[model samples]
Target: MNKVIIDEDIVLKGEHLSIVFGGLKAVEDFNIEIKKGELVGLIGPNGAGKTTAFNLLTGVYKPTSGNIYLNGTNVSRLSPHKRVAKGIARTFQNIRLFKKLSVLDNVKIACNSNMKYSPLTAIFRLPNFWKEEKELDRKAKDILAVFGLNEVEEEYAVNLPYGKQRKLEIARAIATDPKIILLDEPAAGMNPTETEELMETIKIVKEKYDVSILLIEHDMKLVMGICERIIVLNYGKIIASGIPEEIQSNKTVITAYLGEEVE
Candidate 1:
C-alpha cells in the first residue's frame, strides 16, 4: 500500500514468458499486461497451461525464459515470498487454507507477515507487540467480516462449509494486501447460488482495494460476467483476447469450450 510499482497504471506485466518440464513446454510465449483495478479472466480448456501460467507468475515455477514485471520492476527472478512483498498474492483451485487453524487465525497469520514489530518485541511481549497484535486482530476480523465469515471466526478452517472455505482462502489472500491477486478456478465446485455470491464479493473487493485481479476459472458465466477482459488460451498459446461478448461470439472459443450459444 505504501510503496508503488513504477507504472501506476499497470500492476502486472509478463513478456514472452515460457516454462518447460522435461521435454514438454507447459507454456510458450505467454504474455499479458493487467492494469490497476482491472478484473481480467484467463480461461482455457483443461491443460491449456492456464494454471501453469499462474504458477509461473506467482513464482511457484520460474520461467525457462523471459521477464515479468510487477509495478514496473523486473521480478521474474524473485522468490515467491519476495514477489509477494512486491504485491502479488494468489489463491489455489483447491482451497489451501490452514486446515487446523481457526478461520480468524488464518487471516491473522497473513497479517503477521507484514508486522512492524521485531522478534524480540513479540518474544518478550513488549508494548509494541501487544499494540501490533491488537491491530492485526482488528484487521483480520474486518477482512473476514467482508465475506460474512466473522460469525464463525473461532471454527477451524476445514470445519467450514465448502463454499465458505473457498471464500476464506480468498479472504486470506486479500489479507496479504497485495496489489495483484491471481485466482485459480475460484468457482470450481460452488453451486449456482454460491457462485453468484462469489461474483458479488469479487466486485466488492475490486471496489474497495486498489488492486488488479487476474483469475483462471472454468466457469464461463463467472468469467464472462465479472471480467473486464477475457484471454482465451489453447495448447499453451492464446487463441483470442477480447471482451466477454467478443469471446463468446468467436468460433474458435465456441468449438473449444462452449458447445453452441443458443439464441
Candidate 2:
C-alpha cells in the first residue's frame, strides 16, 4: 500500500488492508476512512470478514499487507494497548469485562494510561496518588452517568443485566478518551427494546464524547436508523459503500445477504 497524506478531518484511515490466516484470506484489500464525529456502519453476512477487518484496524491482529494510519501516522505495527493510547479504542463482539470488578473500577482501569502518578507514588499511597485517584473516580462516575450506569457504579460488572453489561463495555471504551471507537456488534443478543435503547445510547456517546464510531451490527433497523453511511462486505471484500439509502438499494448487497442473484 502506498502512503497517502491523511486529511485533518480523517480520524482513522486503513489503506489496502489485507490479512491471510494460514491458507485462507480472511480480509482482502479493505480500505476505510472515518471522519471526525461521523458514525459509520459495517454490515455483511456472517463470516464476511467484518471482525477480521476490525482486528486489523485495532492492532488485535496485524495485517499481512497494507497500512493503518491514525491521523497521519502509520500505526500498522502498533500493539493493541499502543493503539488505544494513540486514540483507537474497541469493544469485542462478546462482552469482555472484569467480571469481579465494580463497574466504576472497570472504567477507571481503561484510564490507566492517562494517570500521571509514578508506581512508587501508588505503592506508598502518596498525596499525588490520592489526588489522581480522586479525579479518576469523578471521571468514571461521569462516564457511567452517560450510560445510566451511575446508580450501579459500585456493583460488580458480572451482576449487571445483559443490556447493562453491554452499556458498561461501551462506557469503558469511552473512558480511554479515544478519537475513534470501533464497536463490534453492540446490539447482538439484545431484545427489541434493549436494541432501541442501545441505539440512543450510541448517539449520546458520539455527541457527548465527540468521537467517531465504526459499528458492526446485524440489526438493519438500527443501522439504517443511525448510520450516516454504510459499507457492505462479501467474501472478505467490500462490494458496496454509500449513504444508507444507496446501500439498501444496491444489487450486490441484496444478493450477498439473500444468497440469490439480482437482476
Candidate 3:
C-alpha cells in the first residue's frame, strides 16, 4: 500500500504515478515528494517523459493510476485552475503569456482570480470593486518589482526581450500565490548570460516567496548550480536521484542523461 502523508513538511507528493496512451506508458510508477522551499531538478534525455510527468502533476493529463497530494490533500482529480487555486502553479515549455497585454496586465490577470468582487460590482464600479482593484494593482506592481520589470510594466509582453518574457511568465505564475511551482524548461533558448540571470532570479524568488520548485531542464549548469537534489528519468522511470554531486557521479545518470560529469 502507498504510504500516507505523515510528514507535514512535504508540500507535494506523487504516489505510484503512471500514465498511458494507447499501448504506451508515457510515465510509469513515478513516486516523488517536494518539501517546502526545496528546489529539485528533473533531468532526462529527449523523450524521457520528463514533461509528461510534469503534465500529470499539473493536471494537464490525468494519470492512469496514482494519486497526487498537495499539502496532504488528495488533489489527483482537480482541474488545472482548481489546482492553481489550491496553490499549485506551472509554467510551460514554450513561454505562454498574454502577448498583447501589458506586463502589468498579464500579472494582474492572474491575481484577478483572488479578487472577491462580483461582476455586478465590477460593472457598477462599486466601492468594494475599487478597493480590490487598487489592492491588485499594488500586488501586481510588487511582483513586477521583484523581477525588475516594474519600469516595463506598461510595455506589451511581446515587446519584452526573451529573458524578461521568461521572467514575466514566472511572475504571472507567482501572482497565483502557489505553494509549489513547476517550471518546464525555464531556460530554454536562452543565452548563457540570460541563463545566469535566470538563476539569480530563481534564487531570489525562492528566498523571497518561500515556495517549493520542481524544474525540468536540459541545461546541466543551471540544474547542478541551483538544485538541492536531482532526479534522472529515462524510459518513463526514475534512473537515479540524489544531490548534485551524487547524481553527477552516478553511472546510471551519467549514461542516461549527463553522459559525463557536468563540471
Best by TM-score: 2
lDDT of 2 by residue, 1-263 (tens): 43457698999999999989898989999999999999999999999999999999999898989999998788987898988998999999999999999999999998877999999999999999999999999999999999999999999999999999999999999999999999999989999999999999999999999999999999877899999999988888999999999999999898888893331
The most accurate candidate by lDDT is 2
lDDT of 2 at 260: 33
TM-score for each of the candidates: 0.94, 0.97, 0.95
lDDT for 41 in candidate 2 is 99
Instruction: Give per-model CA RMSD.
Output: 3.3, 2.4, 2.9
Off by over 4 Å in 1: 1-7, 258-263
lDDT of 3 at 180: 96
| Tens-digit lDDT track of model 1 for 55-105 | 889999999998788988888888998898889999997789899999999
* Model 2: how far residue 132 lies from native, Å: 0.3
Clashing pairs in 1: 5-71, 6-71
Q: Candidate 3, which segments miss by more than 4 Å at Cα?
A: 1-5, 258-263
Q: What lDDT does each candidate get?
A: 0.89, 0.93, 0.92
lDDT of 1: 0.89
